[model samples]
Each structure stands twice: as C-alpha cells, then as structure tokens.
Target: MAPGPIRVAETPLVSYLLRRADDALVLGHRLSEWAGRAPTMEEDMALANMGLDLLGQARMLYAHAGEVEGRGRDEDAFAYWRDERGYRNLLLVEQPNGDFAVTIVRQFLYAAYAEPYWRAMMASGDATLAAVGAKAEKEMAYHVRHCAEWVVRLGDGTAESRARAAAALTELWPFTGELFEVDGTDRTLIAAGIAVDPQTLREPWQRTVIQVLAEATLEAPPAGFMRRGGRSGRHSEHLGHLLAEMQHLQRSNPGAAW
Candidate 1:
C-alpha cells in the first residue's frame, strides 16, 4: 500500500538541511553550464561528472529534508518549485562562471571547504546524515584534488593564465565567508549533535586554500569584508536568472512527466 503523507511540524533542522541541499543544487547547475564548452573534451566530461556528483548529493539531502518535514514533498518539488528568494544556497555557488579560471577557482574554494565539512558530518548523530556524509566525503575529496590541480596549472602557467587565475581569486574570495557563517539554525542543530559547526571547518579550509594558492604561485587575497545573507533567502541578481532558466521546463509543463 502507498504510505500516507507524514505530517511532522517544521523545525530548524529542515531549514538546515535545505541550506545544504540548495548549495549543491545551485552549484551543480552552475557547473553544468560548462557542458560542451570546456577547453578540452576530457575537461568537459570531468566538469559534467562533478556536476552530477553535486546533484546526487542534493537529491539525498532534499529527500531527507522532505522526510524530516513530513510534507510529502520530494526532491523534485524542492528543486523546481522554489524561487530565487526561497533558496538558501551560499552566494558563492550561485555566482556566474566567468571564465575557465573563474570556474576552476570557484570549484576549488568550495571543494576545499566541502571535503572537511562532509568528513565532520560523518559523525553526525542523525543516521541518514551520517550515511550521506560518508558518500559525499569521498566525492568532495576528488573534487578538491581535480579543481586544485587546475588552479595550480592556471596560476603558474603563462602570463595571461596566471593573471586570469589571480583575478578570479580576487573576485570570488569575498563569498567564501558565508561558507563558515553560523546562525540560530546551526546552533540548534549543533546542540542536537545533528550538524557540524561551520566554525570548526574554517581553519582547515583556510589551510587548504592558502597552501594551494601558494603552490599555484598566486597571492591570497587579504581578508576584509565578506558577503553573507544567502542563508536567509537573500541572493544576488544572478540567482534569479539562474532559477528562471533551470525551472522553466518544470514550470512550463507542470505534472507533464514522461
């Protein structure tokens, strides 16, 4: 028999999980933009595969979120029905992919943080989260390595390549702060042992990023003002455009599944 819809009250945990899920979904869509456009055939495939990895992570998290919320909503509902203001992804992930260097730098910065974040989440008290983390940790590790190599290659390559790499770093650095920002939702989940403290991941993320920049022969941007608010449903103009594109097919033909 088909199970009836569960109806648990919405909680901070639902918000927390949605934040992570939105991050993956938005970033995966960003990466998918590189399909058929990468510099090389091999690189094109690589970017697509990584995008799939992130989408897979989003699916798991979104499903878990629906279960927790007991709203009978599935991953498709969360992915397609939400508007720009409804999304809680980090601002970093939704930024435009300007160039190959920009894309690589963005992925590296995100993957560096994601690797450690997922590793810590492996210890989450929630069994579902722990299982998700176990799978995500492995994928994030590969993402870190793949993007880091490109960062180094671009930064240490020709004069033009190095310049582009440097510019990309400067442009994206401000968004990194949101990755480690903690708030009330985080606090509640931390108390329940269901969430990894974002603060705890900052040190390792900095270490990995700094070391990679050094190896790439690029200068790390000085820390100053950092952007925030993605967690609160605020986002850049880019997100609205992205959502419109991504949701168009689903929105246009509602319930018209094959």
Candidate 2:
C-alpha cells in the first residue's frame, strides 16, 4: 500500500463531493419531514420521491467524499455523527417547509443550482467524479421537472396559490446565491480543471429558472442582495435544531449501528 509516488491532494474533488452530499442530505431530510403532511396524496408521493432522489444523491456523494478525504467513515457516519459545526450544508435546505409553496420554491431553486453544477462537473478528470455527475444529472433533471411543474401549477392556478408561490419565491430566492460564490478552495479547483467556476454558473441558472417561472406566470423576485454565508458554515439558526435531532442517537450511543 506504500509503493506509490507522492500524490497531490484533490481538495476540489473532495470539497465538491462534501458540499454535494451535505446539500442533498439536508434537503432530503427536509422533504422527508413532509412524508405524510403534503396537502394531497399525489403531492406526498412527489415530495417523497424527491426526498428519495436527494437521499440517493447524498449517499453517493458522501461515500465518494469519505473516499477522497480518507475520512474512515461512510455516508451514515458522516450524516449521523456530525455536529452543527461539522456540517457543510446550505441554510436553505434546513428551512422548515411551512407550506406547499415554500417546499416547491425551495426545491426548484436547489435543482436550478444543482443541475448546472452537475452538468459542468461531468467533465472532471476524475472518472468517479464524472460518473457520479453523469448519474445525478438525470435525477436532477427530473427534480427540475417536478418542481417546475409545481411552480407553474401553483403560480397560475388560483389567486391564493399564486400569491403563495410568489411569497415563497420572495423568501427562498435569496438563498440561491450560496451555490455560486467561489471561495479559496473553489479557486483551486477551477485552476486545476477539476471544478467549474461557480461565478459562471449563475447566468445559466438564472435563465433557466426565469424561463420556468415565466412559463409558470410568475415573475422574478426583485433584484437585491440575496442571503449568503452557507458555504463557510455560518448557517441560519435552524441548523442547530436540525443537527440536534439528526445526531441525537449517534451522540447518545457511540458507534451504534444497525
């Protein structure tokens, strides 16, 4: 095992996988909270399926992250053992879903951000990274479809639904910025040809999201400084509560496993 030459760190790949896993895990957990609370049976199925897709994405990304970072942990360990400080998830994913509109808006925005990130990452020199992106692209596309459909339906349906959707967008649109800001670690990846420029992903993400909203008869939230700071782990207050719930068993019974 010690026969290889010196290996440079692939921090971008490692960081990318960690970010992706955390996003999926947090959002998937949010969606799962609505398992039986959706307004209708069909909506329950839709949300549940989205949750499954995100959870599946989380597992793959977390497993890859553990491999690349040599963390000696699997997806479950990473997910269940982390305290709030150790989690790298975005704040938006942990927001409580107050209504169907909030859920739709949140999912749509995340899918909008994820789709392009995955599409561009499909070319990573790392075959495992590229393959993971290739597999996730399809699922992410479906997530966009389902959320976009809900966007249109809710936006164009009834006055109440339209207002609700619009309100949801107003609150959720700001969090979209987290997916685009490239930091020091991100710059390394960009220089190494292993990661996309997060700055560049913004325009396409906006165009596609706007087109979907336009078709849905909804307008963009007014331009302004959107909420930020999720990438550096300065999460909103909800993260503590979420981690407390998610990590309780792990903290209570160290190394307990099924």
At residue 51, give the lDDT of candidate 1.
97
TM-score of each: 0.96, 0.91
In candidate 1, which residue ranges exceed 4 Å CA deviation?
1-10
Clash totals in order:
0, 0
Candidate 1, number of clashes = 0
Clashing pairs in 2: none
lDDT, candidates in the order shown? 0.92, 0.81
Alpha-carbon RMSD to native, per candidate: 3.4, 5.0
Question: Which digits, one per residue and each the tens of the lDDT, describe model 2 over residues 11-89?
Answer: 6666667777888989998898898889899989989998998898899888887787784666776787655656677
Residue 22 lDDT (model 2): 86
Off by over 4 Å in 2: 1-12
Candidate 2, after superposition: displacement of residue 115 in Å?
Answer: 1.4
Quote model 1's TM-score: 0.96
- In terms of lDDT, the best-performing candidate is 1
